[model samples]
Target: MVTVLTSGLASSLMDRLRRAAMKLALGEQPPEDLPMIAALALADGLESPALVELAGLSRRDPPADIRDLFTEALAELGLPMPRVEEAWIDRMLDAARAMLSGSLSPYEASDEIYWCLCHLDRTDRVTEPMLLFAGLWSNWEDWPDGRPTIEQNMREAAADLLRSHGEQVSEHE
Candidate 1:
């Protein structure tokens, strides 16, 4: 029970941090919840050096340099800080892998698929899982029976991709 709860908390924290980092990367202000998020990391006992650097900041102290440093800190914390393009691809890959692994549901995967397709062009980073995701998403309305085959293909492709290209989330998380 404790392990599950901790894993859930870490996953939640990683999501928040990733979103904030992406916004900063895109020349946007950090989320209003940034301070609270840092606090939660400390509360959860992740007192890593990178996090300590963040813990020293005042809410109003951020600037463009801060944006770079913020992403750098995430990298130091063992997060896979991808470029915006690769980030979407990574998210898509994660959704498929998690769905196959039973860590996420198809309902959740659908939302992930939608966001990835929105960000990604059809001509690039066309991984096998992406192809399967596109097919599964487009035909879900008319082909209920197709879910099994698509999911089966997804399971195989996602497993193979995960072996070679999956993000290595921090153990501290």
Candidate 2:
């Protein structure tokens, strides 16, 4: 048996992924929802189906480690593995860590981060520091892309989250 070595971060991520797969399997959340469920597990309160779909679209050419883990999980669960690409999976995993750790700068924010933040905000999980960081990087100069600047969006998101949590944020404050 070849022992595959995973980095500390990878191991942590894999552990989370395994736990998520087990939970979804035990909870009867349907096998097809694995990618999204896994994404949610990897990033608390963050859900991006587009990212999951992108991973699926790239599954035909997956990395060895991803394939190994995916195959192992499916086999253990007696479920047929679905087409999920490693590249997208890795991207989603990395994004999950970045967002959760508040390491993503506004300049580095992509549609994925925006959507994830929106989801977190809706779920009342948005934090003050996260909002400040997002706002700091969110500038109108980056506008014209149709979507509002990250700062504006983050500020609004922060307000919404605060409001949902019963906090009254004054306009001046």
TM-score of model number 1: 0.60
**Tens digits of per-residue lDDT for model 1, 125-169:** 454456666566666655878877655554554555455465443
Highest lDDT, which number?
A: 1
lDDT of 2: 0.42
Clashes found in each candidate (C-alpha, N, C closer than 3 A): 0, 3
Model 2 residue 108 CA deviation in Å: 2.7
What does each candidate score in C-alpha RMSD?
7.1, 13.3
The Cα error of candidate 1 at residue 113, in Å, is 3.6
Off by over 4 Å in 2: 1-93, 96-105, 127-134, 140-173
Q: What is the lDDT of residue 40 in candidate 2?
A: 46
Structural similarity to truth (TM-score) of each candidate = 0.60, 0.27
What tens digits encode model 2's per-residue C-alpha lDDT throughout 82-129? Answer: 322322233333443443345753345433344435433332244443
When summed lDDT is taken over every stretch of 10 residues in candidate 1, the lowest stretch is 164-173
